[model samples]
Target: FHAIMNLFLLPLWFLSGAMFPISGAAPVLQALVWVNPVSYAVSGLRHGLHGFAETPAVLAGPAVCLVVTGGFALLTLAVAVWQVRRPFFQT
Candidate 1:
């Protein structure tokens, strides 16, 4: 499970622009970064901490994060409940 989670998160770290500026990446990668939830969070943090200029997207980041986080929480909770309810004999 840990390995699987890392596999998923590792791509996100790069796609989220955490490893470098999004502008420095390829156009295709830049588009992906624009849609990545982590990008908004990072952009928001950067703006907040370093006085980076807030683009319209960056200005919306906090609200987007709240909604995205809530959705993920609900999805995780539903999955956990479903797993717990599964029959033990089911392989």
Candidate 2:
């Protein structure tokens, strides 16, 4: 639920600029574009739409994002599964 809004709706909201960033907005909001998956999605879509990669091949942003997200997901899932499999108290 939270991820859905963060990953999808926020980008749409930002693009519409309905409540933010016409020329002046919070620096934090501007910086969020770098980490929010929506930003990556938008940038990637723009590249595809324009028939060229948005960033140079040397760019590591996407790779870093993928690894970080992947690692977090895996780590959380592992912890959850471990907790399920190993109770705090056993008989």
Best by TM-score: 1
- CA lDDT, every prediction? 0.70, 0.53
lDDT of 2 by residue, 2-67 (tens): 996488676655743234433364666656644554444444444455554454321135556456
lDDT of 1 at 81: 100
Model 1: how far residue 52 lies from native, Å: 8.0
- TM-score of model 1 vs. true structure: 0.65
Residue ranges of candidate 1 with Cα displaced over 4 Å: 51-61, 69-73, 88-91
| Least accurate 10 contiguous residues by lDDT in model 1 | 52-61
Q: Which pairs clash inside model 2?
A: none
